[model samples]
Target: MDQQGQNGLMRTFREPWRSRGALAYVVAALLTGFYVVLYWTEWLTPAAVALGLRSKWLLYGALYSVAMVGGAAYYLRHHGNSRYNRVRIAVNVGVQVALAFLLPLIMPLFGGPEAYLSYFWPLSYDKLWPSTLSSLPVYLALYFIVGSLLVAPLLAYRYGKRWYCSWVCGCGGLANTFGDPWRHLTASSTRSWRFEKVSVHTVMFVAVLTTFLLVLDAATDGATGTFHWLVAGGQWWSVKQLYGLVVGAILAGVVGVGFYPLFGPRLWCRNFCPMAAMLGLFQKLGRFRIAVKKDMCISCGNCTTYCEMGIDVRSYAQSNQSFTRAACVGCGMCAHVCPRGVLRLENAPREQADKARVRLPVVDL
Candidate 1:
């Protein structure tokens, strides 16, 4: 093709159906209506009649619906060269539609647990351990253990946190698509990173402490003493009707998501997600790294600008350093937006991560 023809083709690719924005809105409204029909009609009768309150599934259903439908609409409106977003959308819809919605509805027919698994608070390790100490059914314990421990660790070890954070998590799906336009608001400062570490770990500590106290309280149910009193009080504050239901639903879901426009896409994940923190610990030992090709970088700073996790991507690229941060969720926005193709997500051997690489001159390096 001639240079002018190539220029026209590039322009066409960049401008994707701008006049059809209204069509996205129309599709979103129809999808939401379909979700409402599924929920109200109770077509999935077994799931709608699960052990705990079935109304809770309504909330999960709503989140999944919006993330799947609305998130996709948003992406279609801005369609471009990033195949990553397309994959992310597919994974999000599959998780929300099949796993969160349909599976739960049908699982009850097969005698699954009454309570559904939440992305954040599904596993109560306190209830899972010492089977005789608590009245929690074996099936529920197996569910929590399998989801949080067995499945989570194996995936994080291989793919870093991307397996969940960027692909499957409803919270992260909402962030990546619904909160995408505001992702640049994420703070990329040393101070912010330090604060983020402290905040997220603090939440993780609270979750662990609360779970431990719940176990202790259950084990000493009939005992009476100072220790017992302490345990009881801790259980009341941490578990009785608070942390999982209130904090997880209201603070984490509502407020955390609400602040996306103001604080950036990952307000919850970066600052207060115990799940993200736990997964990050596993990710520190992960092999996947966003490797930088230093010679191709132009220092235009697009990568740094779009990093939803607030990573200083340009600095890593400048120094030929791959992202080693435990906080990285492997979203690949930094690579996707790089005009020069200076970054690629790849696995590096943990043992050889310290090995030397071929050097470029100071000017390019």
Candidate 2:
């Protein structure tokens, strides 16, 4: 290539906002907002609650997404957010506890079946439908068996990261969301990078294994366990319910360090994200993935530091394939930062891994 052409290409490569993680922030907000609105407005359900679509997970995803964004926003406001650690914890437990007490009151408003909230019992949640879920052993058999075979498999297949476990139907996102700000304090290894890597890979393994276990258990109609006994007294202060309140000063301090002090409010996304584990599992068998390119590459490693998940996009960026790991959030921060315009997030078929000698610069990474 002519020097003029080379120079022009080099000139096009430099964009600083990519390094600043500007787009990551943008995408996160947009997604958070998208789901928040959907749930808040009931935008998904039709005029037919009798069809049972109202209780589907899209609604739960929206509800949980609101919880996550709330956690991030909360951590961002409280500087070094160790300050808000207890407050955030309180908010989460309080919301759930309140919901427990309130669901009974709230259900009448919805004109739904009246159900009892077990305050301190083994059954965490139970809704007594107007009729039994199934009358016969075979029909009852489907309840347990289909739990794993149908709902679990379909949910896993549809949203790779156990979206139900993380953002969609996630109950833990309430806690994990607050965890972001405290990430650095919980940075266990002297090797921050290593600590981050081990945690994600570990969770990725657990996520896949557990997700499959859930599927298997559901399919087998096995009666797995739940901890509904934690809801003592039907309010926040009962002994069991109180156990949910302890968010640990150490953990809270970790949030303050990671999000409030060090990275943006999602630092724990690196060290302790089981949601990633679930997502990572789904990601492997799933359709979409981040595509990377190496040949036209200049290795100015901006994408690595910007990763809230602590994924080294630079390593992936230097490759010619879609990163098969589940950790990649499909967050396009890497593609947004390429100096040589070598990175991109593509849904190209797996067979098309190397068709582009030089891929276009992704503006929306």
Candidate 3:
């Protein structure tokens, strides 16, 4: 344990991983580029190397597959440290955010006669056109693509979602990495269960409503994508503000969950996340989730204490109910922190005929 022994041990451990980072970049870039080609195949009039009009899931499956196998290989070889998925994280959010603001709508910020401004949203049929609104399927697929292909695995695979939010997500990482001073935003959650109930429910409803109205507006005119760019310098200004709002929400969670780990666990996940609200749907239908057994239960609140989403893990562990709650993020904090090996992660629930079988109390049958 002396400094010299520690130094020798560190040296021994550091050498084998000679810039795994660089190779990860190369691989993610190539894989992303391959998906891009797959995406553009519909427009490739010549039908060159046609993937032949497959199901959307097939394409997503391919993307997810590449990300998984590649991510797993990295996971097995690397420690589950911050360094493991840096490449994938950077490429994932980097490409998405850059395209979000820097594409056609970006106006030069320096030459403005009036105040400088920027745009955050995109244009109609210009870039990710379907984001504005179209068919229900396209509309539904909008955030699904953002979360599933982009966000989910980034959270689920190696390090977890906190890593994704903290490191890779440009907007998320900003408040997380630099806005510590503004940590007060999220810390304001109510301690009273009743108040927490009202506030969290209100926030969730409002977010969903705002999103719905915004989508309805865009879909109605086929112009929502084009609206932000109407004024030349307006978009980037909007982007600055929008990114702040997104970060503010994250701040709420971080302060509620990350900083105040002792007072309680993750406040945002339990109370505020609209995205988690949406993810919970798939989580209900999701092939994967966490599981628990009654015999191993210790009645300790360790899992509940650490949960960012704020479910009472100890309660579920004590009952016959499934652990895969709709709101569960599957962040694995509960699994990692469980001292008695009482909590576990697992798959989706199975469907049954007419009605799912339910056990009832005996009444002298």
Query: For each candidate, what is the lDDT?
Result: 0.65, 0.41, 0.40
| The best candidate in terms of TM-score | 1
TM-score of 1: 0.74
Q: Model 1, which residues run further than 4 Å from truth?
A: 1-60, 109-111, 115-137, 225-242, 351-365
Clashes of 2: 15
Q: What would the per-residue lDDT of candidate 2 be over residues 1-365, giving only the tens digit for each residue? A: 23211212233224332222465345445544554544345555663254443353334433444665676565334322232233434444454434433454456567653232222110111111111223224443455345433554455555444233333322334434544432222222236555666865664454344334434444545443332222223466533333223221122223422233234434434454544444455666665556565476565665554444555566556654445445555434355445565665544345544433343222212
Tens digits of per-residue lDDT for model 1 on 1-365? 23111112234213222122454345435534544454346555555456343654654575556665786776545543466667777777668666666666767667764344545342233334343224446666676667776788778878888888888777787787777656776878877887889988888887777667656665777265665455444464535345655446544655566556556778888888878888888887777777887577888777777778888888778877666667887888778767778888777675365344433221111
| lDDT leader | 1
Worst 10 residues of 1 by lDDT: 1-10
Rank ordering of all candidates by TM-score, starting from the highest: 1, 2, 3
After superposing candidate 2 on the true structure, give the runs of residues whose Cα lies further than 4 Å from its correct spot.
1-108, 111-159, 162-190, 197-260, 339-341, 347-349, 352-365
Clashes of each: 1, 15, 12
Better of 1 and 2 by lDDT: 1
- Which of the two, 2 or 3, has more lDDT? 2
